[model samples]
Target chain A: MSTSADTVSMGGGNNSPSIRAKVQAFGGFLTNMVLPNIGAFIAWGLLTALFIPSGWMPNEEFAKIVGPAINFLLPLLLAITGGRMVGGQRGAVMGAIGAIGLIVGADIPMFLGAMVIGPLGGLIIKKFDGLLENRIPAGFEMIVNNFSLGILGFLLMLVSFEFIGPVIEAANNGITVAIEALVATGLLPLLSLINEPAKVLFLNNVIDQGIYYPLGMQAAAEQGKSIYFTVASNPGPGLGLLLAFTFFGGKTSKRTAPGAMIIHFLGGIHELYFPYVLMKPLTIVGMIGGGMTGIAVFELFDAGLVAGPSPGSIFAYLGLTPKGSFIGIIAGVLAAAGVTFLITSLILKMDKNTEETEEENLNESIEKSKAMKQEGKEVSAASEQHTTQIEKISFACDAGAGSSAMGATAFRKKLHKKGIEGIEVKHYRIEDVPEDANIVVVHKDLLDRAKIAHSDKEIITIENFLDDPNLHGLLERLENVSK
Target chain B: MLGEHLKGNVRFLESVNSWEEAIRESAAPLLENGSITSKYVDDMIQNVNTNGPYIVVVPEFAMPHAKNENSVEKTGISFLQLQEPVMFPDDKEVKVLFALAAEDSTGHLDLISDLSGVLMEDEARDELKQAKSEKEIIDLINSVE
Candidate 1:
C-alpha cells in the first residue's frame, strides 16, 4: 500500500518560497556552468568519427584512448551533472565521486553507471543533508557550514562508491555469466516451453526489470564488441511477439501486433503489451519462448549491432543496426517465433483446466470458513471482532513516504466514492507508522512489520493500491465498521 | 576558494532571444571583462551547434560553456537569464544561464561542482529566476545556506 503524503513528502517543501528560489538559482548555475572535460569528449568523438574512418589513427590506439574516455569520462560528467540536478553542490560532488567508480569498475558502461549511481548518490547525500544543516553553529555559520558540509559530502560520496561499486560489479558479473551459460547450454527448447506460457498468460513482459532486457543487454554487452550490438540486443517479450507476428505469425495476431510493435519499436518502449498479457497470459508464454529462441539463434549466428537495445522494435533494429548481420537477425526472429508459437499453443490448452481447479479450491476455502463460523467457534469471534474495530486505516509502501502517500490518495478516492467518511485515513512508511493505528495496510512484500503489529491491530495485505479493486472492497469494509 | 573564484565576475542577465543567442550574448560580458578569451566564446558556440542542447544541464537552467583552455583569460563566472524561457532540445525548460570561464580543467573543478550544487536546489533556482535585480541575485547567491 502507498499513500499520497508519503509520495508528496519525498520531494519535501518544493512549495516553500526559499526552496523555490534555491531551485531557480541552482538551475541557473547548472545552465551557466562549464566543464572543460566535455571538450575532451567532443574532440574525442570528432577524431574517432573522422580520423578513425579515414585510417589516420590505427584502430588499436583509437580504441585505447577514445573508448575508455567516451565510455568513462562522459558518464562521469553525466553523473556529476545528474547529481547536481538532484541534490545541488553536495549532490554534484557525490555524483562525481560515485561516477568515478564506473571507471574503476570497468564492466558497466559509464552512461549506465552514471544513470544509476548519480541518483543513488543523490539519495544518500539527501539523507544526510538535513543532519549536516542542523549541526551548523550560529557565529561561523556562513564559512563553516557549506565548506565543511561540502567536504563531508565529498568524503561520504567516495566511501559510498568504494562500498557500492564492488557489489554492483559482482552482481553484473553474476548475471552476465548466468545468461552466457544458459545460452551456451543450448537450452532454448526448455526455455521456450517455460517462456511461451509465461509471456502469453502471466504478463511476463510487464516485469522487464526482472526478465528480458537485463539478460539480453548483459549477454550482448559482455559477449559483443560494439555499443550498437549492446543496444540492439535489448530483449523484450513484446519484441518477441512482434518478431513472431511479422516473420511467422498468423493473420489475426499479425495485423494487431504489428501496429502496437511499431509504436514500441520507434519509441524504445516495450511495456505496451501489459494489458494484453494480463488478459491472455498464454500469449506472454509465447513471447518468453520467442525471446529465448531469439537469443539462442543470435548467439549461433554471432550477429552484432551497435547501441543498447532499449527500443527493441524492428525499425530501431534496422535503422540503428550496423551493416552485415541481416541474415542472422532474420534467423533469430524465425527461431524465436517458431519456438514461441509451438510452446504457447500446447500450454494454452492445459491452462484452462488448472484455472478451473484453482477456482474450485478458492470456493472450497470460503465454504470451510463459513462452516467454521456457523459452529460458533471462538477462533471465528477473534476474526469477526477484529474486523469490527478497523474504522480508520493507513498503509505504507516503498520510499515509505512517496508510495504510501499515493496509496492514501487512492484509498481516500475509493472511500469517498463509497460515501464512507468519519473513518480517519492516513499513510506512513512502515518505519514511521504509529503503534496505535487500528488497521494497517501494507505492500504484500513488506508485511513483516504489519504482522508484528497485528498483535494490537488488524493487518490487510495489498498488492499495490494504485488500481486494485479487491483492495478497494477490503478498505471499504474496514472503513464502514461502526467502532 | 569557490567564493574567491566566483566573486566580481558573476553577472545576472535579464533575457536573451534563443539558446544560441543566449550563449553568444552571455559570453560577451565575460570576454569584455577579460575573464575569458574570445576563443572560449567561439568554442562554446561551436559545441552547441554540433551537439544537441546538452547545455541545459539542470532543470529550468542552461550552462553555456566550452573547454576552459579555449577562453581562460582569468577564472571567472557569469550569470544570465531569459526574459522568456528558451528551449534546449534536451531540457524540459530553460530560464537561467551560468557561463563559466575556467583557465584549466583542474583549476575550477571544485568551484564548478560547488556552484552546481547551489544552483541545483529548487528554492535557490526559483529565487534566482525571480530576482528583479542584480543585487537580489547576488544577495540570493550569497545567502546560500
Candidate 2:
C-alpha cells in the first residue's frame, strides 16, 4: 500500500518528503503520549467515584494524600509533558509553573484544571523560551545561563499567578458566562454553520477556544446553562465522515472507515478520521450538511451534552450526556451520514483526473532520488579508527534546564544500551560551545547559531528532541564512550 | 472545641521582618499559653518547604496551621499584619498572615468556615487591611456577622 509518505515523495516540488514524514510521526507520537494519560485520568475518576463514596477510603486521609499530590505532583508531571511537547527543559519548568497556577489559583478541581492549564503553561513556556534565547550573554555557558533563566522564569510565573491570576480568572469566567447563554438559547443551527468548517480546518483552535477554555461546563450544566458550543457537539461532522465512508466510500476506504468510526464512537477522538476528510475537500460540504442534519436531530430529540465536544466520541456523549437519549444519538448519526454520503459521492465523481496526476508525480520523485544518490558518495573511513575517537557531543536547546536535563538523561541511557564508549556528552545553549566539541546537536531554528559556534563540528539538527526516538539511540551511542 | 480553647491564646502582630518571623511570633502566644506546642510550629515550616505556598490559598489571606498533635494545648487563632507586605518566595504575592492554631482537625470546621467567610468578604478585608491598631483589628474581626 502506498502511504502518504510515498505520495509526498512522488508529488515533490517545493514540498519536501520530510514534512509529510514529520506530520505522520507527530500524529502517532501525540496519540501514544496522550492515550495512556487519558486512561490514567479516567481510572482516577472511577476510583474516586466508586471507592471514596463506598467508604473504602477515609475522606480526611484521602484528602490529605490526594490534595497535596494533586496540587504539587500533577503540575510537575504536566510541566514535563508540556516541556516534551515544545522541546526543552525551560518549557517544561514554565509549563509546570503555569499548571501550578491554574491548579491553585482557580477554584476548579485539580484533574479538570490540568486539561486547561497544561496547554496554557506550554504557551507561557514557549514565550519565555524565545525571550531567554534572545537575551543569552555572549561569554556565559549556554546550559548555566538556561538554568538561571529557568529560575527567573519560575519566579515570574509565581508572581503572575499571585497578582494577575484573579483578573484572568474574572475575564475567563465572563467569557464562559457569555458562551453559556449562547448555547442555552438553542442557537445550534447557526453555531453548526460557523463551527462545522472550523472543525474541519482549524481543529486545534476550536478545541482551545470553543471547548477547553470553559473549564466548568459540566458544573454550569447543573445550572441548565453554558456558553461553550461546537459542531463536535452531538453527532459531529467527524462522525458524519465515518458514517459516509461506511455507507458510500470506495471499497478500500469503506474497509478502514469502520475502525475510524469505532475509535470515534468509543475513544472520543474524532480527529482519527481527519486524513479521510483532508484527502477529499468535498467531504467538507458533506460535513456541513451532516452537521446541520445532526443539529436538527439533536433539537428534535432534545438531547444535550453538558460539556462541549473536543473529543466528540460516543463514550463522552454517554458519560456527559443526560440519561436515556439513545434515539437522539441514533438520529444525529443518521442525519450526518445522509448528508455526508450524498455530498462526498458528488465530489468524488468530479475529481477522477486527480489519480492520474498523482501517478505521474510519483515517477518524477523516483528519478530525482536516483540522481541525488548518484551524486552523493559513500564514506570510506576505517571502522576501527572511527570507534576510538572521543566524540564531543553538545546539545543546543530552547532552555538548558528541564527538558535538556531529561534529554541528557535519555542520551546517557541510550549510550549505555549501545555498549559504546569514549564519548563526552554535554548540553549547551544555542551560542555556547567549548570550540573542541566534535558533534553539535541543536533544534532546527537554532541551526544558524550551531553553524557559527562549531563550524568544524558535525551538526545533527532536530525539530523536537522529546518527540524523536532516533535522537535517543544517537545519544545512547555517545554515552557508551563516557561509561 | 479547638476554636473555643484557643480563643484567648491567639496573638495579633503589627509588623514582621519576614513570613517565617511572622509565623514564629504569632505562634509564640499559642506556645506560651500552652494552646499549641513548639514542635507543631516546626512541622508547619517543614510543610511549607515540601509544599509550596499553600498557606496563601486565597488572596491576601493565609491560613497557617499544623496537625492536631503538633501542640494544641487548646484551639486558637492569631492575626498578624505587616505595615508593608512580606514576600514569601514560594508565593509571589505579599501576605498578611492569619494563623490558626487548632487542637484537632475536625472540631474547628464551623470556626474555620466563619473566619473564612469573614475573610472572603471584600468590605471586611478592606477594613481589616486599613486597621492601624490591634484593638481596631480585633473590633473589625468581631464585627463580621
Candidate 2 TM-score over all chains jointly: 0.41
**Which candidate leads the pack in lDDT?**
1
Model 1, A300-368: lDDT tens digits are 776654333433556645543434456676677566656755655555445444543433433443343
Position A43, candidate 2: lDDT: 35
Residues A341-402, candidate 2, lDDT per residue (tens digit)? 67766765566556445344324434443332222211101211233244457765433322
All DockQ scores:
0.01, 0.01
Show where candidate 2 strays beyond 4 Å.
A1-36, A44-80, A83-94, A108-154, A202-283, A293-335, A338-483, B1-145
